[model samples]
Target chain A: MQKISPLRSSIEAFNKFKAARLNKADKAQKTNQQSQTNPFGITFKGTVIQMDVFEKAEKVNENTQKAISLKEKMQNTGKLLASAWVGTINKFSSLKTNAIAFGNKIKDSTIAAAKKIRDFGNTKVEFDVFKYNVSRLQNKPVSELRTMLSNELQGVTNE
Target chain B: MNNKRVKNIIEALGKHKDEESIEVLNELGTNCPIDEIREMTSKALIRKNTHRALELMIVNKGKGINDLSARVAMCAINELLALKDKQEAIKILDDTINMHSEKEVQDTARSVKALMSFSS
Candidate 1:
């Protein structure tokens, strides 16, 4: 069996400690090299992530703009459509009122023409309806005159 | 469940729309990876009585699947639009445009687009 010596044990422990320290130092140096030497890779990666984030933000902004613009257009169009309907109704109402006035004027003219005909019926007027009727129906039946003639003839017969 | 019962349940889930239908459609979109099932999901989305179906169609459009029948449904929906639904309808029309094969469908889409533009 080998006997353990204190000096040897202490020396061994010191060597183990140095090895761990060397390993940690090497790791840190490697990390520093990665950070310092390859600037383009880091910049490329950062640029890519930044651009991706920007693209996503741009899309969100676009969608928001679309929603806002669409809403505005809808509101405006709705108002315009309402105005058009109101205007159409107003136009139709005016047209109807004008038509009614024209109709009343025509009816008044027609009645006046007929009154003139009745008043100047016996006169030689061009538009006298009574004279025109008597002229046209001259050969048609005259029941009242026939009755009068029959009554006179009956009187004669009785006499 | 047997295949027949499972299919009936899935179809029922598709037809009777609710949260359950959304869940089933999602499941069908992901797990049940058959062309026919996918097509059925697309068709069901076309028939769904809500805008969720259109949203699903948009997702499928992003995934590069073409659903032609949905285009016809979109045309049918175009006739019922007020001004408020123009944007959504335009988007649906845009997505549906790529799926059409017949000229009549294209003409219908063009006319609807023209009408929307005129209204605008």
Candidate 2:
């Protein structure tokens, strides 16, 4: 006896539902064609479908693909932000030798990058997670900040 | 992932100081990889104003990710501040104006600060 995985079962169920719905739509189209009749004994008639079914199906499939891509991106939100943060920090440290000469420019660029990171967190992170993160951040020491982000990055990547 | 308990604790924190409870909830919300639970807790924190709800809204106002929630939270924060502790709210907005480089965020802070000033 073989055991099926829950994820596999859920996917199977979704595919079955989708197939059944599509079949019903095809059957309905056929039924509509069969129900068409001519009045006054005029028997010469043909059914003309306006919108292409295949096109509609392709459109639906495209939307589904887009949705799947969005989900994948959402899952990577933590990692993306984490990498950005690390990159910004490294850039700053490497430029420390020229700090006096490029002070204003460095500061401005760093602030801009930081703003982008915050924007990413605020937008991409779910609201509850955002709130929780804000509160959690208040309690943490500055030294431990990277640990938190790294953990988030790991969790997202691991999944 | 006990969402019900998290909700209850957040409600309690709104009324009284529960440092440990808030800390635990914050940890759960931060550490949980599950999207749905984190979302529920985020909403809970916003409604209670336990976290940096207003600050988050101010920073994220222009970005399209969670506009509706941010708008609603901004309104709620405005009302709450308008009723009490207006100075702190004004200071927060002022900091946002001075510190943030994003034009959208600065504009949002300026408008909200003006509205608060007018209302008060």
Candidate 3:
């Protein structure tokens, strides 16, 4: 009994067209589902069959085992490398300590030798030798002095 | 001979007052091929401070201030300048300037005399 507006009529027509298109799309989807092909090229109708279920599970288990083994191998190789590096560092440190100890030993021996020589030089024998040489030089004749001086001069010149 | 032995001998000769010591110094110290020996000899002669020693330094060529080696010559000049009693040195220098046959020796003597007078 009410007057139909132009905008309402157009919206009603659009709704009807949309309902028909949805019904057609639903029918097409059902038809596609009835004859859908799986990724393995096997066609099935209506309900999906659980094909190759045990085989897929076995393949997945195999891949998981391979990954775990690879991870364990990488971890073992890293542990071995770390141990080798630590051993090398220990060896180098030992060598360094040995070198320092050897150097200290050489220094101590050298100092001891020098002290011994100094002690020997401080003895009365050294003084007596020096006195003897001086007295001998004082008593020497002029000709002898000349000859000694000439020899020393010639020696210095040669040097 | 070792350098220490040579040094000991030079020191012994320097302390000796015998005329033969002077002869040795003049012959070996002054005429040596080594400049160090010449320098040591000049110092030894100056230590003697005798008239003959002064004469050797002032009158001789290639010895003392007249030495070819400038280091030896300067050492001799310094020893002369350091003398507590320069009267003998001045007298010898004057004699060298007046009576020395070499003109170079006379000039060296004159220059040394001027330096001595200035230092005094």
Candidate 4:
């Protein structure tokens, strides 16, 4: 029987997870398009404007917070994966049963952490599109946009 | 406390756009001592009736009123003007151009008039 390697399975799972998250972001952007209207009344062909200014500001803040938390988790997970790899190399055969089980657990968790980081990247792409649309549609000056964004951030935090 | 109450009332009236709300908003917008309250009333007035809001905004466009408030008022007028009949829109813009001293408001009213002419 050909053995399915744990590393290969984890890699496949991670790729599938990343693809799902990217698809979710695309779907969210498509759904939000109905509410967004071009201020000039001329819709640019194929230009997607999903989030309004306030929502865009809030989403950016949320994505930043999530990314920071995931970074911390990934660092911790990296340490655990490294220790598990060392154990597999040094303690293999002597504690083969226990080492493989521990190594698989570490691999699962590391893939989960990697999926979270990729999800954050997907959300960041949505946020970038939102920012571009706000600039294009509203035609607000940077100072005004900054002031409006700060006001929205404050409103979100206060709630 | 009283100012907040007035602000809340203005918001409710503006949202409802009742038959008599325009008059009340116009009075408050024009005579209210507090700038914040006055601006609130001006916005409410604009929301309640852009035509009436235009008259009130033009009346308030003089020295003491806030420039921001007048700008908002002008924007509302321009939008409502588009929906109004051509003659009525022309009359309103002519009156605004003649009676209003604010160059920005006058320029906008003129442009609105020209746009109406070109569209018609």
Candidate 5:
């Protein structure tokens, strides 16, 4: 007799979530690579402004590169924030982060990422769990995104 | 989770809140579970029949009103404050303060007065 596993179900769900996220990341990276690769000299604010313009864009823009630039830069920010909070989110997988209730399996292992994810929590979760992936990624993080941008400005100044 | 309890709260909003009724009704619009009671309470006060709202507050006597909790109280108080009827809020709040004892509820009443003063 075959027995169904709830634990397996959650794990499968989690795995599927991870794969989709990575696939989105791949598409974003491909677009940016296709656009223009900035070898360590990318201005964070420039990317932020571009993303802001892309976000406010209701339809396709005259410049597809601008859209991809925003999407790619945002992916970079997401990874950096997640690295900061990996600790707490991994510790408490059972508890749902109020900020990002559905999207982003917020374990205790990651705080900064989860918080950033939560800052955009309203848009972070999958609408149909697989139907529409990363659509909400367009909302953008105003605060952390600004901070990352300001730091990039500092880097530019020193250069 | 409990729809049945919710219906009862809507019904209570229609009636008077006695000691026994307020205790049970207080549990409706909070972490316990959200229900139409929140919507109904706000709606009932909007009619602005100050005479009736005050009557219910006094009749209930503040026994289990704390079970009604702070947020609901604050919401209702804000409505009353909007109508610029401090007497009604003051009457209910002071009555609740004298009869019942909860720091949150007390603070809400105090804040309402502060807010009203600031506006004036």
Candidate 6:
């Protein structure tokens, strides 16, 4: 109700607003501190039970690592078996091809040897003697030739 | 013993000029078990161009053109046709055709004579 200037009254209202905001900020900080110290404000008085939770977690981690290593080893073994199987098959194929080649070589050599033997038989000394005897008979006496030829023919017929 | 040797012997006998050679050819060459020997013998006889060889070829049974084997028969006929002096062969063929007892031999001689006339 007292008379006041407009600027002075606005400044007084701003100061009152600042003081109320400061009071609210102080009360929020005190409540935050109280929650950080003890939120429910209750205490446990009996003997506390301790569990080895971190140890169990560490054991779980070690088991997971062991399982991962075993899986990797199994994969490696499977790859090794597949490669060995392929290598064995390739070896067998090469062996079979070599065997066939060797067999063919033996067969060809045998045939060549047989042909050489036949040629040798054809050019023997006895065959030349038979030829010479046939040519020599042309100059012999007719009666002697006839008797010789008759005997030869008789032998041939007997055979 | 060897067939090649026997064949050469037959060829040698064919060149001999003696009459006894004919008898050997008739006995061994014509009557041999082998057909090739018989064929060679017939050709040899024709090459001799003698009356006796002509008689054997034209008048004999199962000899020369009348041979049992058709290949031998054909070879003998071919030999007769190929003769440079066919006078003696023609005469014997005429005798066989007119006077031979066997009708088969007479017919064969007649056919051969006809072929000879055509060739000349």
Best-matching candidate per TM-score: 6
Weakest ten-residue segment in model 1 chain A by summed lDDT: A131-140
**Predicted structure with the largest DockQ when compared to the true one:** 6
**Local accuracy of candidate 1 as per-residue lDDT tens digits, B1-120:** 123323333344445524445545554432343444445455444445355555454434222122345443343334324435556656765655666655555555556566767776
How does each model score on lDDT?
A: 0.53, 0.55, 0.82, 0.58, 0.48, 0.83
Per-prediction DockQ: 0.00, 0.01, 0.28, 0.02, 0.01, 0.31
Tens-place lDDT digits, model 3, residues A1-159:
999999999999999999999999999787667545433434458445444542555455788899999999999999999999999999999999999999999999999999999998897564534732645676677677778878877777777
Docking class of 5: incorrect
lDDT of 6 at B105: 91
Candidate 2 matches the true fold with a TM-score of 0.30
Tell me the TM-score for chain B of model 4.
0.53
Which pairs of residues collide in candidate 3? none
Tell how far residue B38 is off in model 3, in angstroms. 0.4
User: Candidates sorted by lDDT, descending order?
Assistant: 6, 3, 4, 2, 1, 5
Residue A82 error, candidate 2, Å: 99
Q: 3 or 5: which has the higher lDDT?
A: 3
Q: Give the total clashing residue pairs for model 5.
A: 21
Between prediction 1 and prediction 6, the one with superior TM-score is 6
**Candidate 2 vs 6: which has more TM-score:** 6
Q: Pairs clashing in candidate 2?
A: A128-B42
Better of 1 and 6 by lDDT: 6
Clashing pairs in 6: none
Per-residue accuracy of model 1 over A1-159 as CA lDDT, tens digit each: 999899999999999999999999999887666655443334554532222432444345788899999999999999999999999999999999999999999999999999988888767656434422332323323333233223433343354
Ranking of models by TM-score: 6, 3, 2, 4, 5, 1
The list of candidate 5 runs beyond 4 A from truth reads A1-159, B1-33, B55-74
Q: Over the stretch A1-159, how does candidate 2's per-residue lDDT look in tens digits? A: 899999999999999999999999999788666545422222335544333322555345788889998999987997899999999999998788567668888899999999999988788554555444445554554324334434444454466
lDDT by residue for model 2 over B59-118, one digit each (tens)?
654221123445444544445444455665567679988998777677767777788788
Residue lDDT tens for model 6, A67-113:
99999999999999999999999999999999999999999999999
